[model samples]
Target chain A: MADPFLLAATALVALALGLGLARFLRGPRALDRVVAFDGLTIVSVAAIALAGLVTGRAIYLDVALVYALLSFLGVIVAARYLEGGEQ
Target chain B: MSGVLDILGGLLMVGGAAFLALGGLGLWRMPDTYTRIQAGTKATTLGTLLTLAGIGMIEPGWALKLALIVLFLMFTNPLSSQVMARAAHRAGVPLTPQSRGDALADDEGRAAE
Candidate 1:
């Protein structure tokens, strides 16, 4: 239960999540929130992958893959909506 | 051989996490949306890739799927960031005062004509 790698990775990711959340909450613009959200999602993908590694299961990687795809699509949609939602 | 792989995987994962943290910090501290996008996207992309690579190294068997995820991220992260930046620009988001020029603004004007 005391895996150094897992512990280190988790701590670093937690730091990232905290910072990203701070940006998201402190956003001065709508698009700023969007950008922070994107970063936060990517960081989560890494965290999921680390979880997969820790558990010794490959399934979590698949979940990470799907999450990444959804994140990309979501960001694209959000950006388009911000661009006056044309077309 | 096993020991070497374990060490390498741990190193890669740790390094990746460090990059992720840096990306987050940049997102927090960057003055403008454009700069935040640059910092957030580029660093996170590398960080995610490295973390995935480390996972693949440690497990070996999951290499193929991890590679697929890596390839997908390579294409999407930057594309999404570019989309966001373009949208922000079109939405009339202004650059910081210190920013010298807006090349896209010139092109946008031409396009509007």
Candidate 2:
């Protein structure tokens, strides 16, 4: 059976994701949006990991890892571009 | 014993999720860009790490991989946020009125000579 706590945790993470999206949409500046985007990605990682735990699947952990790496790279690249580091 | 472990894992997951929610709220409520980044990065990093560790506790065999994920996040999250903050500063995002000073700005001024 899936753990009840894991289910609750997933719901919490989803709520956090919604809040991040709200900030992203309400941004007063580009960087504010980027910060919100970063928060969204981190919460998504937590959500995915919690899902893997609830489902009893090891493979989903791999997916979470890859997603984390890709998100980190994307944030860094976007930051660099914002800093005028070239296209 | 298994039940005990399950309870522990559940507690950790709940705590982690609470922190994640706190980070999101900070992002919504903070006064300025740098403050929001600070709130988001610090809280989410701890939240994600706790969540991964909780998952590892639930599945002993997956502990190693989960630990690796946590380590990667510990390293990357702060670095990425720092980069973002610097970029925001350079892009001329203004600080809130309560901000004390810009040490980086002073450094840049000294370097320009």
Candidate 3:
């Protein structure tokens, strides 16, 4: 049987993703958008892990791990560009 | 015993999702870039960790790999947030008007001498 609690949780996370997207589009400064982008990634990771739980699949967990790693790198690169840390 | 575990895992998942949503709210409502980063990093790290732990409880065989993901997240999330905050500050992103102080500015002034 599908767990109702997990289903609700996933729905809530999807709502959070929408909110993050709003901030990303409307943020006044570039860094504000970057922060919103980072928040969206973290929420997406949570959603992926929960999907693994709901579907009885371990492979999704691996996908979550790799996605998290890539998101971290993306944020760092964006931050470096904002800071003008490299030419 | 199995039923008990299922219930516990479900609870953790719900709680994690709640925190994740709270972080999103903070991101949308916070006054400045630094505050938004603070909210996003702290809430989402705990939220993801709880979700991973819930999954581990549900599927015991996947626990080892799930633990590794949790560990990596704990290390990277805050580090990335810190980098973003520092970069924003250096890039001259303005703080909220009510902000009381700028310690980084003081540090830069000291360094200039």
Candidate 4:
């Protein structure tokens, strides 16, 4: 049986995603958009974790870890690019 | 042992999520981009960390991997938020009139001359 706790967590994360979505739509600048993007990555991780918790699968955790690493590196690269080419 | 930890982790995760929601609220309510950035950065970081920890608790065998995600978020979340704020300033986004300092001027981030 799926744990109710996991389901609840997922619901909360979904709500967070909705908030991020609204922010993205009206962000005042490129950075604000990026911040909203970062928020999306966080939401993705939360969704996966909540699913893993509910499903009792260790595999999803690994997926979440990979997702975190990629998104973090991606944001950094994009941020660096915004800094106007290497110093 | 596991049961107690799981419960604790869930509560923490829930609390953290609530904090994130609060941050989102701040983002919506705060006037100006600068204040919104501060809200997003702080709230999301704490919320994500707690959510990661809850995952670790739930998936005991994969705790190390989940922990790594948490650490990565700790590092990258703040750095990116800071960078975004800096970029905002460089691009000439107007700061709130009463902002205490040139926050985007890299004053805090500036290394000693």
Candidate 2: which pairs clash?
none
- lDDT (Cα, tens digit) per residue for candidate 3, span B1-113: 58777778778877888898899989988999889998866788888888777777778788899899989888988889999998987777767888998788786784211
Candidate 1 lDDT, A3-80, residue by residue in tens: 698789899999999999999999888899899999999999999988888788888988999999998899998998
In order, what fnat does every candidate score?
Answer: 0.78, 0.76, 0.75, 0.39
Q: In candidate 4, list every pair of residues with a backbone clash.
A: none
Which candidate do you rate higher for lDDT, 1 or 3? 1
lDDT of 3 by residue, A1-87 (tens): 327877878887998899899999998788888889999998898888888877888899889999989999999998989885322
Candidate 2 Cα outliers beyond 4 Å, as residue runs: A85-87, B110-113
lDDT per residue for candidate 4 within B1-113, as digits (tens), equals 57887787777777666766666666666667667777765677788778777666656677787778788788777787777766655555667777676643575585212
Clashes of each: 0, 0, 0, 0
Give DockQ for candidates 1 onward, in order.
0.66, 0.67, 0.66, 0.45
TM-score for each candidate, following the candidate numbering: 0.93, 0.92, 0.92, 0.81
Poorest 10 consecutive residues by lDDT, candidate 3 chain B: B104-113
DockQ of 3: 0.66
**Candidate 4 lDDT for residue A43:** 69
Which CAPRI category fits model 3? medium
What local lDDT does model 1 show for residue A80?
89
lDDT at B51 for candidate 4?
74
Q: Assess candidate 2 and give its lDDT.
A: 0.85
Could you list the CA RMSD of all candidates, in the order they appear?
Answer: 2.9, 2.8, 2.8, 4.6
Encode model 4's per-residue lDDT on A1-76: one tens digit a residue. 2256665666677777778778888876666667777777876786787777667787887898788889877877
* lDDT tens per residue, model 1, B7-72: 788889889999999999999989899999999877998998888888778889999998998899
Clash pairs detected, candidate 1:
none
